[model samples]
Target: MVLKESLLELLKIKAIANITIKELCERADINRSTFYSHYSDQYELLTSIEDEVLDELQNTLQLYNHSDKNETFEMLQRIFEYMASKKDICQMLLSDYGGRNFQNRVMSITHQYIIQKWEDEQNILKSHSEYVTLFVLSGSIEVVKSWLSNGMEDSPEAMARWINDFTSNGLSCIPKNENSRLK
Candidate 1:
């Protein structure tokens, strides 16, 4: 646990490629042998952390059936709540330093869910489903990144509602301001 926490902390400041085992060991307050016994290298340790999060995300996705709109929204809220609960690790892993692999993995986990939801609720064409899914997932990822970067002042429920509204209702769901450029 200490090693994983230490690696995540280091990731906040530097890329995984630049982080060395010695530094990680020092940060974790353990010797090189201890780290080596658990992970052969920094990348392995990082992968371990990513896998843990991915597993939990997959499990979370399973908790909701997505059979209805309300259930879908609840699932999204639950995901955001999970992210909030693991703020530090989520923030770091979703950041630039964390690399696209983790983000891609996350998208992969949620891809089927999003695709099924759109197909059932929106009646989206099968041929266009991939594009639509990509667009929504990309936007949702950016929203999560922004939410994490902003210290998550809003509650998870609020974030989930905004995301759901934006995706389901499009731009109309977002209120316009006179000073805003959307108009």
Candidate 2:
């Protein structure tokens, strides 16, 4: 636990590729042998942390039937709530220092579930589903990153609603003046 937390702290400032085992051990107040005994290297420790968060996220997604729109929103709310609960780590892991690997892994996990839901519930054409899924997931990830970066002033429910609304209605979900030129 100490080592993991220490690594997370280091990740906030530097990428895992740049973090050394000695620095990590010093951060955790442990010796190099102690860290080596549990993990092979910094990457292994980082992977361990990512795996833990991913496991919990996968379990959270499995708790609801996402095929239904309403259920999907609820599931998203729960996911945001989970992210809120782990704000520190989530923020760091999603930051530039966290690397594309973790983000790609997250996308992979959600992509499977979301694409399945879209195919089953909306009957989106198979040819277009991948593009649609990638667009939605990429935007959703940026939204979550923004929410976290902004200190998450909005409630998870509210964030979830915004995401769901955008996903379902696109730009139409935003209101505009009657005289607005763009229609």
Q: Quick one: best lDDT, which candidate?
A: 2
Number of the top candidate by TM-score?
2
Q: RMSD in angstroms, candidate 2?
A: 1.5
Tens-place lDDT digits, model 2, residues 19-78:
999999999999999899999998888888899889998998888887777987998999
Q: What is the C-alpha RMSD of each candidate to the true structure, in Å?
A: 2.1, 1.5
Clashes per candidate (backbone, < 3 Å)? 0, 0
Q: Pull out the clashing pairs in model 1.
A: none
For residue 45, model 2's alpha carbon misses the true position, in angstroms, by 0.8
Whole-structure CA lDDT of model 1? 0.88
Per-residue lDDT tens digits for candidate 1, residues 88-174, read 999999988988899998888899777887688778897798887889899999999999999999999999888888877898897
